[model samples]
Each structure stands twice: as C-alpha cells, then as structure tokens.
Target: MGLLDELESEAQRRKSNDEDASVLKAARETAYRTVLEPAMADLLAYLKELAAKLTELQPKIAIRHSLAGYGDVVAYVEHEFDVREVRQPSSKEITVAFHAAVSSSECPSVQIEGGARVRAVSASFQRHRLGAPLAASKDASGEVVAATFKAKGRIPLTAVFSADAASGQLRLSFSNFDDFATAVKTVAPDQVNEELYDKIGRYLMREPTDLMREVLPENYRSQLRARVHHEEVKRRWESQIVSRQQEDIALLKREYGIGARFNRIGDAMGKLRGLVSRK
Candidate 1:
C-alpha cells in the first residue's frame, strides 16, 4: 500500500487497540469496586479485630535451652500481631495481610551467649520450657547468638490475604511458615528440633473462639449470635423430626395385627396341649 494509506491504517489500528484497552480497564475497575472492595472490607475488619485481640492478650511463650558446655537459659518470647490494612497495588487488585512479631523492642525474645553449636543445643529445650519463667542470668561467657522473633528476625510469620477482583475469590497464604520452622531448627538440636517445632507450631496456631467477642461491634456480634442460634435450632428440630418418624414407624410395625397373630397362635397351641395332658 502507499505510505499515506499505511499511515492511515496504522492510526485506525491504534485507535481500535486503545478502545479495547479502555473497555478492559473499565471492566476491571467495576469488578474492583463491586466485588473486591466489599470483600476486602470484611477481611480488613476481621484482621483488625484479630489484631486488637492479640494486642490485648499479648500472648507469650516461654523458651528455655541448655547445652553441655553452656548453662541453662530461659527466655519469655511474646508475639505481637500487626495488620497492614487494605492497599490497592493495582487497579484490579487489593491485599490485606498481617505480620507476627512486628516490633522487636515490644516483643519478648531469647538472648543467648554461646557459639552456634551451643545455641543449637540449647534451643532444643524450647518446647520443654514453654510457658516457664523468663528470668535468666547475663553472666555467661561465650559467643552470643541472639534468636529474635520479630520482623526480619528469627521466626518471622507473615500471612497475606489476596482477592481476585473478577472472580471474588479470596486466598490466604502464609509467607514464612517454612522459614519459621527453619529458624527454629537452626537454633535447636536435631533430636529436639522437630518436637520443638511441632510444639511451637501448635501453640501459635491456637486461637480462642471468644477472641472476637470484644473486638467486633456489638450489633454485629448480636446478629452473628442470633444467626448461629437459628441455625442450631433448625438443625436440632430436623434431627428430632427424623428420629421421631423412625420411632413411630418401629412402634407401628410392632403393634400391627400381623405380629399379634403369631403370638395368639402360639398361646392357643400351648393351652390345648395342657388341657389334653390333664384329660
């Protein structure tokens, strides 16, 4: 084609592409507004409630370790949760997440003065000493291995919540679960590391059912309780109806004339045999 014709064709192609792009952008925006935003709001509210609960409780784990060369050491490691709030990274996306052990100074940690081997050996006792006293002496003489459980420190835990704008599907993922386990292993001996890791994991996974009782708004909680009660009552009534129907069927079968005929026949036969023997 001529230069002028080619230029005009390219212009039209560009315009078409721009229109398609605009349509996609608008669709994404609508999805984000109608789907992602509402879902994220609920998630953010839940996270905030969880954060408030954790902050108030300030749940702590007691860790203690001992080595052949190094003496026994005890530490009180506390976990603090921090929510990142909602953030829109792109036009079609939103994210909500929380980080455990966000503050170092605020979180309780274990400070040991020993070499890598000594630290590893001592940390093996972490699970055993969980919830024990945190008092420790600072007079030990050895290399220092500080195992802090904070952001960018030992045992960092980050949970991310992501929602797809178009589908409204929510995904929850932990970023550092393996890292958390690895950090525990690094400071603990092989024999006890697994046990310690399992124990710590179980401890961390625990969440009180009533944690949101105080954090959620009163109206929301009342609504939730009412809904739960309604569901429970409905289930109980359904089960009772099924059981009653079954019992009724059984009783009817037992009292039916068919079964009575067999009993009557046996009784008559016995009476006739007794009369004959007397004669």
Candidate 2:
C-alpha cells in the first residue's frame, strides 16, 4: 500500500516481462541458427548441384517429347526430368521430393488396327467421359466430367537426414532415384480394362458406329462409371499432395530467409545468454 512497495512491485513486474521476451527471442534465434541455418545451407548446395546436373543433361534430358495419339495426331509433353542424382551435398541427408503428373484425354477417331476399323480413345482417359452408355441418372443429366489419370508420390527424390522427420518418405523409396516411371504407374488412376473398352466402342467414338448399339453391355457401363469415380478420388488426393508439397517447401524457405544473419548478433546473443543465466 506504501509508495515504495508499489514501486518495488512495478519494477519486479517489468523485470519478469523483459525476461520472458528475452527468453522467447533467444529461443527463436537458437532454433534459427542451429536447426534452420544448417538445413538451409545444405539445401542450397544440393539444389545448386542438381541444377547444374540437370543443365548438363538438358540436351538429352530436355528433348521435345511427342506422343502419337489417334489418327497420326501427335501431342507434345513437357521435358520430363530423370532423377539423375539425389542431391547428396553432405552427410546430412535431404529429401529432394518432386512431383510428376501426366494427364491424357481421348480424341474421337477411327483407326485401322489388325485390318479392322476400330473406334478408340486413350486407355487412360477419364472414366466419366463415357458415362452410363444409355442409362438415365443424375450423372447423365449433367455434362460428363472426365478426370485425369494422375499418379504422384513424395518419394524417389525425397530424402531425410534424421531418423525421424515429418514427411511422406515412408510412402516412397528414398533410394529409388531412377524409378520415376514405376512410381507414376503405381500412383496413377486405374485405367478401364480392355474388356470394358471393347464393350464401350460405341460410347468412345466421337460419332458412334452404326454397327454398335447405344445400350452398353450388362455391367460394362457400371464398371466404367466405377473406374471413373475411383480415378476421381485419386486426382483429388494427388492435387492436394502437390499443393502441400509446394506449401511446405515455400514455408521453410521463407522462414530461413528471415534474419538470415548479422555478424555482431552472435556475440550479442552470447552476452545476453550469459546475463540471463547469471540472473
């Protein structure tokens, strides 16, 4: 209740607040200097080496890839990167996770195969594209939406230095650097089977052949629809995975860049820690 007592209490409160703030700042700086700095430095080096190697392989690795689609039509795809090497810059293992996705659509076309005129579409075409051949349903009422055959894994190029790291590395084989194609196939949407494709010849064609009937074979339409739905689920999950991959990478890099370093800051921290411990 006395003036001196009130002043003493106020001084003690100020000291506590200052100590709390200093502890938090020290913790942040320690985490940045010890955990984040080294991780970032190794990342920079790994990425630099990777970029150089990719650049060297660009001549062969970066070729214009063209796929012959229906009727001699060719579709060009992006220059796919072969994981020539996972950036092993140091003893500290880093997960070099990259995403690969491919989307294919069918073109309405007639092609002669085995001397027979066949109406065909891409085997990997989205299932919904060929909805219930002639069945009436809510799906039939709406414009048919086709989903892409997307396969993705956060592995292959992904690595981790520690015994336990928060990542999807468990799903991927960290050592399988050159197995990109296999990885894609493993994650890709299940394509409609050949038997179902044969049954839906009329449905796949841009212009239905007169010999074929609109009525799909018993169970074939349902089978095709089921495949479409299955693939749709995969697409949704794949996209989310890709988004998260970018988000996590961006967040880490951003945090690393903040207060990267100033020379005296280290010495200043040493003094601050000494004082705090003495108190």
Candidate 3:
C-alpha cells in the first residue's frame, strides 16, 4: 500500500478501539493542558499580582475595620487575637502556648510582651483611604495623618455563550457516599467519571468566572485616576523640595567662594596700579 493508504488503515484500526483510545487521550490532554500548565500559570499570576499590590502596603494598619460596609479600600493586614499565658523558658527556649479561656463574654485585648511572638497577618491589604475625602484619625498627641475611609472593588465579565446551549442538569446519579464527600471537598476524586469534571468546569465558568462577572462603579476610572494623580503629586512635591534645597546650598557655596576672593583680588589690582603709576 501507498503511504496515505497505510495511514487510512491505521486510522480504521484506532477507530475499532475508539472508546479506550478516547479515555487515554482525554486523561493525557487534561493532565498536560488543563491541570499542570494552566495551574502553574494561574498560581504564578496570583503570586505576582499579590506581590506587587503588597509591596507599598503596610503590615499592620489602623482602620475602622468592619465586614458590614466597604470603606476606602487599600492594603490591609488582619490580626489574630489569641489568649496565652506567659511561661518560663526551658533549655531549648521554645515558647509554648495553650488555649486560655475566660468566663467573661468579651474577648479582652492583651498587652503585647516584648520579644514574644504574637499571631499577626502581614503584608495584606487593609483598606485604601483618601487623605482629603477620608475622615482624619486622631489621638491624644494630635491629629493623625492616615487614610481612613476604605472601599473594595470587583472584576466585571460578560457571557460569550448562549443560555439555552449552556444550560445543563447537574444531578447526583452516583450512590457512593465517599465519592460524594470527596466531590464536595475537591469537586472530584479518584474513580469519578469525566462528566463530573465537565459539569464542574461549566458551572464554575458560567457562575463565578469570566462568563458572569461583576458590576463596577460608574466613576471607577475617575476615582482611580484621581488617586494616582494625588500620589504622583505628593512624590513630585517632595522630590522638588529636596532638589531645591540642594540647589540653594550649592548657590550659597558659590557666592561665599566669590566673596572670599574679592578682597585679595582688589588689593592685588591696587598694588599693580601703583607700580604702573611709578613707572
């Protein structure tokens, strides 16, 4: 047979075992494309984005923190309140802690001990507040210059596929309780069929993913631009003040040098004039 005829015969041979062949291909394809590389890309993007966002953010922020309403949004670090008793150090000096419960209803704040490690959330967004628009926070000393108001934002999306075509029935066809528990934890587990994967993908994509995004504020662009402009202006002003101070110092040095040489030059010119007159 010719090369094309041999290839046709091979294709026919594969078609006879199509069911098993398809399962093997699907496993390999999902492993290579959907799980490994895609997962890596997603994780890298998340890490990089978080790193950039938290670079300028503070670890512990003073905010009027509440989960009810959004305030001026910015980087925030949450703190875990723990009750622990102070204990004497051992030879290894490992600090040990046990659950310290109290009869009081309120969770009392404990004074932090020096050199003792406490539970804390670091390098996370607390909330962004405006210098002008936000309310000023103050203390016994004086007025505090910190961002007060905080708000949050969400990403928007649009559906690319039609509703009728995308709609599907997700029913519990299997009777395995262990499989159901695993599915609840990770959406899938070993011995689970491929249709479950497809159903999860479709559900996630359409419900919370890009297919159905969020609604943003109308003046979001203006607000973002204004915030950036304020930051740039503050930076520029400080830079100009530093540069202007340096320039003034240099100008003073130049003027003082000229003043120091003026009298000596004048005296030399007088002596030279006197010598010329005598000649």
Candidate 4:
C-alpha cells in the first residue's frame, strides 16, 4: 500500500504540471495571431510606399532624366550654344546656359567687345506661365542682327534674346527661356508633377542619423546601445517561444498518450507558426 500511494502521488504531480504547460502554450499562440503579425505587415507596407515616392522628383536635362530612387535621389540639367564671326560691328557674341534646377540663367561672358555696348544680361524662369515677348535688331550694313533683353523681377523669368549668325545659320541663345517654355507647354503636367513628387520623397527619406541624435534625450548613449539591447530582447522572446513549444510537446506526450515523435513534430509546427505571427 505504501508503494502504490507514492506512485499515485507522482502521477497527480505530472498531471498538474501538464495542465500548467498547456495553459501557457494556448496563451502564446493567441498572442502571436492577434498582435504580432499585423504589426509586421503594416511596417513593410509603409516602407514600400516611401520608396515609390522617392523615385519621382528628379530633374531632366537634354536626353537624360534625373530623379531620386528608393535609397537616394538625383537631379541635373545641361545647356549648349555656339559663337561664330559675322560681318557686323558686333565682332563677339555671347551664349547663356540655363537649367531648370537652378531656376535662373545669365550670360557669364563679361566686357564683350567689338559690338554695341551690351548694357546688361540676365534671365528668368517660370514652370508654367504665358510666353513673354522678345525683340530683335539689325546692324547698319544689314549684314548682322542681334537680339537682347533686360533682367527684371523674380525667378521664372525668360532669357534675353541674343545670338550669333554665321554660315547661313542663325544660332539663337536665351537664358531660361527655351527650357522653361518647353517644360510648361510641351511636357505633360503629370510628368512634371511626378518629378516634383520624387524630390519631396527623397527629402523625406534622407538618413535620420543626425535627426535621431538631435531628438534623443540626454539619457540616450551616443553608441546606439539601445538597438543592441532591443535585439537581445527580441532574441530572448524568440527563445521563450521555442522553450514553450518544447514544454507543450512534453506535456502532450506524458498526459495525452501522444507519441514522442508526433509531439516533436507538433512542437516544430508550433514554433514556425509562432515566428510567423510574432511582431
């Protein structure tokens, strides 16, 4: 009778232990499905949207296009003109290169000689505005013609009329005029909007290291030890999931007469499900 009583006591203890393990396993499964999976899904969706926005705002120059990408952004523009000798008092000519990125264009050449005194040179650019008027003039011998305009107002201004005529070719030059005009009328509004959007996206997605330092409290360490600590915590949480799964399998095998091999397989499935649902 004494030996039988001891055996019964051991059985009861095993049953109680199995009950506790089962309760913990159920709670963990519930938490994984209810909380962790949704959080991870939301995080990935937001990152994808951010990458798309960053690709839209780059500038266009010549045949090449510029814009930001998921991890970075870029913008560029180019302008070209030529200078040639003509039969007139104006022995020298000037050209201006304009880029929409800068929003301004002006002839860099200074103190130009052998022509009528070029009092001033300047340019302006506007993304979408009505075309402004320009004027042209001819030399006394009618062998040479030149165009010029004054600088006025804020950005989005037109280039002054200026050109060099030679060899039956009239090379016209204007600061911001041609590009701005093309962008406003020839380019589709949606295309321009997309470029601007990309620029804004790039600005927003810039690395946040500087911002993080500025915003962190005094208690925060400069070495980013917090990230390491967070990773350790995550590791521990995953380990707990594995431990819980093993305990569950042990309980099932001991109390429910489930085979050891079958319990082991169930434990693996539980572990996979836990990881999939974890935040």
Candidate 5:
C-alpha cells in the first residue's frame, strides 16, 4: 500500500479505539463519584475526627500516610505547654502541669516522673483547657511559626485529608504538633469545611490507573504505539546488517575487482562510520 493509504488505515483504527476508550473513562469516573467517593469520604471524616480528638491532648501528634497498600509520607508534631512552678519558703517546691484535652480519653493521666524535683505541696491539680489560635509569628529559621506545645510521652494519631483537583493527594505532614492540637480543638465538630472535606475525599478515592488513563489522550496513546513500532523496525534493520554486508562482498567480487572478504569489511566499516557521523 502507498504511504498515504497506510496512514489512513492507522488513523481509522485509532479512531475506533478512541471512542471505546472515552466511553470507558466516562463510566469509570461516574462509578467513582456515585459509589467509591462517598464511602471513602465517610471513612476519612471519621478518621479525621478521631485523630483530632486524640492529638488535642498534647500539642504534637504523628500521622502516617497510606493509600491502598502504599505508604507515602510521615508527619510529626512538636508541642509546647505552659509550665507553672511553685516554690515554698520551707524548702519545698511544687510543680503543677496542665494541658488541653478533647475528651476524658485524651486527658494526661500519668504522674510526672524522673529527677525533676517536687517538694511538699499543699495541693496540685491538672486542668485541661481548650486550644486557641496563636498569633502569626516567624520561627528562627524565618518560616511561618505555627503553634506547638510540649508534653510527656509520644502519641501518634492518623488522619486522611486530600488536596485540590490540580494539586492531587495532599498528605498533611504537620511538623508543629501544637498547631495540629490547636486545630483539632478550635475546629468545631459541626464547623468542618465541606470544601476541604470534598477535596480530601476526592483525593483518597482517586485510583492511579484510572488517573493515568484519564490524563493520557487517545491521540497520545496512538502516538506511543507508533513510536514503539518505529523502535522495533529500527532494531530489526540493525540485525540484517551482517547479511547485507555479505551480500555487498559477493557483489563487489563479481562486479568490481575488489575481494569478497574486503567488501564485507568495507561495508561494515562504512555502517560504523555512518553511525559515528550521525552521532
């Protein structure tokens, strides 16, 4: 067939495949929104509330990111708490500790241990308060400083949140534990941002394979197939060089006065020279 005819046939084949591919993509996205996304959003919202409550006790919390069977990112928080020290005149010193907690489960119930001295104190109480927003400030490194708090023991919390459509999956890596705790406490149960929830939900429900097929157009796929064919043709052409060299040697011996063996060598050298010059 002529080059034009061959190209027309290829185009026709791609057009047929393109229609089916578009239909399949549309169906998949519909199914994702109607079924998969709602389920994922419910699970994510529950996890967010649970993690927020748990982390509210201290200023810091750790959240590990996971999707389908893959682990993506790890986040940590550093918390800071106000410490009050009471020193009595009778050589007795008393230290009182307080931190915020969301619920009874989140209350810091352990006693302060270690070499930290505490003398005869009349009374001590642990008061849990609600976390509030911190004024904007810059850290020593010139980065925007977020709220943080100090507390005993290492507590890990897990939460799932997503990003915008263009940004993709957003795994929040909270370095300021205190800020996370404050966010949990300050964010009212009924006041959660619906837009944020939807964005995060969409991200969590996203499937990589589906996303790949969605982003790649039918024309791009056709181009990729053509490129693959071209590469295979190039490889096969290289494999036939040795036989072509032999054929050249026979022709040289029969037609010209050159030796058959020298013809093969000369043809091989010429091919190498062409390759080097092209590079």
Candidate 6:
C-alpha cells in the first residue's frame, strides 16, 4: 500500500524474473564456449593467415592499379571486418559470420575522367563584313569516382565466412570484385589486435547481448545505454526503499517497546497508535 511496500513488491518481481534471466544467460554462455568460441578461433586464424598471404602479394598490387592525373595518386583504404552472429528462429541454429564484404566506405576515390561537353558556332563574312562566334555547353560527364571502379581478378577479396553451430559447418560467401587487394594486404598485425578477439569471446561467453549492443549504431547504442541506466537506477532505488523501510521498523520497535512479533509496517503503526492512546 505504501511506497516502500510497492517498491519491495516490484523488487520481488524483478528478483523472480532475474532467476529466469540467469538460467538463459548460463545457457548462452555454455553455448558460446561449446559452439561459438571454436568457430571464432578458427575464423580468426584463417583471417590472419589470409592477411599474411595478401601482404606477401603486396608488390603485385601496383600491377592491378592504373596511374592517373599529373602526379601519382596513391589511395589506401582500410578494410573494416565486422563479425556478427545470427540465430535462426525456425530451428534456433546459431551462425557466426566474419564479414569482409567490400563497402563503398572501404574504397578509394580516384577521379580518372576529366572533360566537358561544349557547343559552339562561328561565322565569318567573305569580306570580313561580319564575324560572330557563339558558344554553349552541355553536361555529359557522370560523376565517376574511384569507388565505382570494380576490382579485377578471381581473388576473393570481399568474402564472408560463416560457421554454423548446430552442424559445425563452415561456409564461405563472396561479394564485390577486387580492383586491388591492397586493403587486405595492408592490415597491420596490431590493427587486428588479439584483445579485440578476446573481448568478443568474453562477450559471447558471458554477455551475448553486450556483443549485439557493441555493433549497434551510435544512436541506438545511446538509447540502449539510457534504458540500461534507467533499469539500474530503478533497482538501486528499490533496494534503498527496502533498506529505509527496514530501518524505520527497527527504530519504531526501539521507541515504542514493540515486540519482534510484528512484521508488517501497518501492524507496527497500529500497535504504535494503540500504545500512544493508552499513554
């Protein structure tokens, strides 16, 4: 009935739900260790080897690129490799994917075309009686940038490697051509830090939801953080409510010589009221 009682009830409800959440969390952690972790390790190892091979082939990168403009325009783009896991609703199959598919953001802008469409008319009289020149222009050049340039070669540059948990199967899928495998070649050892993999592993093992949150867009992540903060604050407030109510009951008992027989605040208050009337 009182604020303290309401808060205590809510806390009890949360405590019950937290038991269910804990079970689910434990199962997810088990799944991560038994299934996802091995796949992730395998994938990371494969990528490391692939990256080393690409680096060894770095010298061949120049052969794939064409020179343009007055000076050599060397463009270096970083390949962003994203990792994510998907769970199929139908079968509840978990699949982890290492995404290296080329995006426009990973491509360099090389402007190779420079020109304009123009129209002009000129007339001159035989005796130089009259001479006139007229000029007009029309736009024709499409805004072609280096990003549009498709990478040539049979090499699988933009590829996705997905591992299925249930079947323990690994699949490879490819998208976008490689104009230059330079990006893959340039991946520094430090850039692919082991710490990142460790963090991912830890998330998958202990907090899978946190891993999902990590990949969320900035705005969405902010919203998630705010919601989580709200829940934490509410939990702390409820705890404080319980503590404050318990302290009040203890103080009342001390002041009124009330026995430990009473439990509820309402009962304590009623007893206090009766004592005051008698006094």
The model with the greatest lDDT is 1
Runs of candidate 1 with Cα error greater than 4 angstroms are 51-79, 86-153, 160-174, 180-279
Give the TM-scores of the predictions, in the order they appear. Answer: 0.33, 0.23, 0.22, 0.21, 0.25, 0.24
Clashing residue pairs in all predictions, respectively, total 0, 2, 17, 12, 12, 3
List the candidate 5 regions with Cα displacement exceeding 4 Å: 56-160, 163-279
Residues 108-218, candidate 4: write the lDDT tens digits: 112222234321121121222212213545468762234333222222322221111111111222333322322111111122233333432332233222211224555
Model 5, position 156: C-alpha lDDT score: 32
Better of 3 and 6 by lDDT: 6
Instruction: Please write out the lDDT profile of model 6 over residues 1-279, one tens digit for every residue.
Output: 999999999999999999998886676555545655565565566555544554455322211222222122222323333444443431122223222222323334332332311111111111111122122222456432221222211222344444433333333332322222221111212223455445434432223323222244799989989999999999999999999999999999796664544446778899999999999
Tens-place lDDT per residue, model 2, 45-68, is 554465455456543221111222
Order of the predicted models by TM-score, top scorer first: 1, 5, 6, 2, 3, 4
State residue 159's C-alpha deviation in candidate 4, in Å: 51
For model 6, the stretches where C-alpha displacement exceeds 4 angstroms are: 1-11, 59-74, 77-279
Least lDDT summed over 10 consecutive residues: which range in candidate 3? Answer: 158-167
True lDDT of residue 113, candidate 3: 22
Among these predicted structures, which one has the highest TM-score?
1
Count of backbone collisions within predicted model 5: 12
Show the colliding residue pairs in model 6. Answer: 110-146, 151-178, 151-179
By summed lDDT, the worst window of 10 consecutive residues in model 6 runs over 117-126
> What's the residue-level lDDT of 112 in candidate 3?
24
Candidate 4 TM-score to native: 0.21
Ranking by lDDT: 1, 6, 5, 2, 4, 3
